[model samples]
Target: MLDTAQYRMAEGDTLPALLERYASAAKATEEAVAALPDLDVGVPLPRTPWSPPEPEVWSARRVLLHLIRETAQHAGHADLVRETLDGANTTAQR
Candidate 1:
């Protein structure tokens, strides 16, 4: 297994690349959350088909829009968790 120190990237890799990795790892969860109607803040997205088990994950239209929405959710959840644990809230309004 790779050690923690060795897992660190060298120079030239942007920070968002690291964040994107985390987002990618949580892909399924993000997609699931994104499919929820309330998750679409002011955006009237198409109604995604019910993601049934055994094969049908989600429709193509839902899949295409998932990445952006997923990443945003990751960022939001991270912020809240970090702030609460740190004993201080973020100044930036969500």
Candidate 2:
């Protein structure tokens, strides 16, 4: 389980600051992924409550694909929220 306490927002946190941090982290991840010499390298998955019963290994390629999938999912969710707030359909044809 994640330590929610450690991830909680600070008292003065603002949306802009949070977005800036997210952008920086995303850029760093992109750079790191690009610099990886081999995508076939694998690592043992961490054992967690939600993880599979048997140990499994994930390759760098798999991890990258997972990250891309997750990011796209989150972006879609964010778009939904934005559309709800502004009554603008982001995906609608112009």
Candidate 3:
């Protein structure tokens, strides 16, 4: 019953810029998946094929899972980096 898209922030369309694009895409994937109803999880993806040997890219299901896993990884990195700068991992403390 719902669909979603998001803005992409980029540097200048190069390797370093690809970082922002990846982060943008990951964020967009997250938002789109979250907008779906539970029943939508196994349904076909809207923009891309859900099964692929064609592009060798992840499927929608895999994208969703990766978003979750990578969110945790990025959060951990943020926490660790923050700690290195100021001595804290706030989520761990709270």
Candidate 4:
């Protein structure tokens, strides 16, 4: 895992710059995934302190599913925050 502290934005960094960086990274990831010939291909997992004790390999499909779930979780959290600030139901059906 990366040391996130090292990648923290500088004090002078603007919101637009930060958003643009995230957008670029997301596009790159999408392109890379699109190029993959087989989503079932598995790779040895990097053993970090947070990793399971047992050895593991993760297929590309599993990784993508995890990413999707995590993104949804974050979006939910953001919606909660937004609702707290203003009584708006962003996810409610129109």
User: Per model, how many backbone clashes are there?
Assistant: 0, 0, 0, 0
Q: Which stretches of candidate 2 lie over 4 Å from their true place?
A: 6-10, 44-49, 52-56, 91-94
| lDDT per residue as tens, model 2, 18-92 | 989999999997897788888998867766656777989999899889988998998999999998899988465
True-structure RMSD, every candidate: 11.6, 2.9, 9.5, 3.2
What TM-score does candidate 4 get on C-alpha atoms?
0.72
Model 4: residue 66 alpha-carbon error in angstroms: 0.7
4-91: candidate 4 lDDT, tens digit per residue: 5545778889999998988998999799789888999886676665678898999989988988999899899998999999987857
Ranking of models by TM-score: 4, 2, 3, 1
Worst 10 residues of 1 by lDDT: 39-48
TM-score of 1: 0.34
Candidate 2 or 1, higher lDDT: 2
**After superposition, which runs of candidate 1 have C-alpha atoms over 4 Å from their true positions?**
1-51, 57-61, 92-94
Which residue pairs does candidate 1 place in steric collision?
none
Positional deviation of residue 11's Cα in model 1 after best superposition, in angstroms: 26
Candidate 4: worst-modelled 10 consecutive residues by lDDT:
1-10
Pairs of residues clashing in candidate 3:
none
lDDT of 2 at 54: 93
Candidate 4 overall Cα lDDT vs. reference?
0.83
Query: What is residue 58's positional error in candidate 1, in angstroms?
Result: 5.6
